[model samples]
Target: MTATQAKPRQPDLKTSLPGPKTAEIMARDQATLSTSYMRPYPFVPDFGKGVWLTDVDGNTMLDFFAGIAVSTTGHAHPHVVQAVQRQIEKFTHVCLTDYPQEITTSLAERLVKHVERPGEKWRVFFSNSGAEAVEAAVKLARNHTGRQHIISTMGSFHGRTYGAITLTGSKTKYKRGFGPLLPAVSHVPYPNPFRPPLGSTPENCGQAVIDHIESLFVGILPADEVAAIIVEPMQGEGGYIVPPADFLPGLRALCDKHGIMLIFDEVQAGMGRTGKMFSFQHFDVQPDIITSAKGIASGMPLGALLAKESVMTWPVGSHGSTYGGNPVAAAASHATLDLLEGQVKHEGCGDSLMDNAAQVGDFILGELKGMQDEFPFIGDVRGRGLFIGIEFVKPDGSPDGALRDQASMMMFEKGLLNLDCGEAVIRISPPLILTREEAATGLDIMRGVFQELK
Candidate 1:
């Protein structure tokens, strides 16, 4: 099948969702699995191919969520699967740090090359997940600057680990009851054009955020003590928020002025999700460090901390991971990158998958905006590339979390897989390889849900 072609057999729902087999598996899952996992609807998957998922009972569903944007090349891309299979057959383990592997080194080289900047050399440190990448970046920033304080934006979701969760400011639930978090971390408001704070306009929101950071420096934290300022180019969990155009550039200037490292947490927005190899590429400014993982290896467990070589001054034993750059995962990553960069193009598809993201994402955004005009609950529609979000709000313009939840569940019941983020925002982060027809199908389901909810 061509990259842009929709599955010939679309969403064949034979039985009610959570059919007999699904119910049986779910019953066993509830008994054995941890309650921490949030399964919004009982759509248990037996297998997936491309943008389609098959439940245990043979019900087919469209996967617009892409496993939370981890499946960059789409589910079970032949290239990635073949690469993993070949690598595993050779040998999967042999901790890279303890015993160097060529595949891991090769993948790191490619990642460094992808982020290369003139007069600035980059190096990659592998980890097992986005949180680990964040942790590594934080440690490296501290070690390089010899400073303790770190800054993150409000409405940001870094990760769930202690240091990562400490940096997250999107929701208190993630931080609640896990207090005494890594100290010296502070959160400043992130610029949101749609719901500007203090009634700031899009033109001034960036400046307002900078002014707030300046105030913090003077009143609370000393600028010299701040080691780094981490942010997402396009906020993900904090509601696929796209900051004002000037926000990132202004933040970069501020970080430079304070001699602070600027870290871009592209775990959710990177790896071709935003029509670029990295989301920060959308802005002219460059960050000192980048944490990437999701979609890096088309759903494989891998994370990377890409940093300027000069800033990664910590000694050898300072950090290491046993499974950070498994050969199998690295092989898969190489294949994933191949498809993303268009080195290996499927028949009749565009040169690169990122190009597809731009085209289809614009189409999806246009449709959502058109729908917003008709639906009062769609208070806002914003995003870049495929990483879009639709905010639900009451008539008074207050966030309507309940309505958002209801709509999301309704979409699931209709055989469309989606996810909610922030307080009342529904995020649409499908695989980068998504086609226009597939996107329209998902949006149609959303429209039906919105109509019913209204």
Candidate 2:
């Protein structure tokens, strides 16, 4: 088949979703695994290729969520697999302390180029996941600045670690029982146009955030004591909420004014998921540090903290990870970066894939706007590139988490995999490699679900 003709497709359901056998497997899993970490879906994915997954029952399903925004190069890309295969044949792991590997050095070099600052050099510290990246970034900032306080927004979702969770803002549910969190963290309001707090409009939300943070410095923590301000250029789990045009640049200015390091958590939105190398690129606001993990090394566990050289000065024995830059993982990352940089493609389709995201994302967003008009439950729809969200609200446009739950279940039953976020937002950040036609098909399926709910 030709390159275009070989594009992956949506799921073909010959039988009901989660058929009897899949349900049996999931039920067995539920009985054995802890409920806290296990969320049994209707499908048991056996394997995936490109944009489609074949479940154990031999059903092919479209992968819209892309393993929660990872797999940007799409599942099992030939080059990535080959790289991993080649590495395993040679050697799997060599302790970094004793033997530094070429693959790790190459991956770090590639990362430095991607996250370079205009006038300064860059460095990276590797980890196993996004949360670890955030923890490392916060620690780096603390060590570099000699400050104890960190600032985050109220609707953020950093990670689950004590330090990361302390920096997260979405409350109670994730933080309820986990007490004695890392201290000296305060939250400012995150900008949300659809349901602004204190009756503010979208246009003014950026200024409100600035004012709120400024008030904190005056009343709570002093600016010099604040080590870093961690934020998502586009909030991921907090509804894929894209701040106002001024939000990021404004925050950058505030960080500059206060001499606090700005950290961008690109864990979910980086690596072409936002149709760019990074979401921050679209906004022209450069963060002092960046935390990235998902989509960095395809599906393997890898996260990195990219920082300006000035803030990267940690004394020896400050912090380290045993498997942070494992050679096997680094080989995967090197191959993944090669694909992202257009070195490997079916037919030079990498950039075209980004263009596909913009075109298809525009159509999906338009369809969603139409749906919002028809269904009052849809309070708003906003995002850049392919990282989209649909916020649910009451008749008065306040958050309606219960209604969102109902609608999500309705969609799930109809063979779509969607994730709920914030209080009542539905996020649709699919893989970067999704074709225009596949995106339309997913949108159409979603529209049908919304119509059925209406």
Please report how far candidate 1 places residue 410 from its true position, in Å.
1.0
| Model 2 CA deviation exceeding 4 Å by range | 1-10, 38-40, 346-352
Task: Give Cα-based local distance difference scores for all models.
Answer: 0.90, 0.82
What TM-score does prediction 2 earn? Answer: 0.93
Candidate 1, residues 247-288, lDDT tens digits: the string is 899999999999999999999999988899998899898899
Q: What is the lDDT of candidate 1?
A: 0.90
- Model 1: residue 188 alpha-carbon error in angstroms: 0.9
Q: Worst lDDT window (10 residues) for model 2? A: 345-354
Return the clash pairs for model 1, or none.
none
Instruction: Using TM-score, give the best candidate's number.
Output: 1
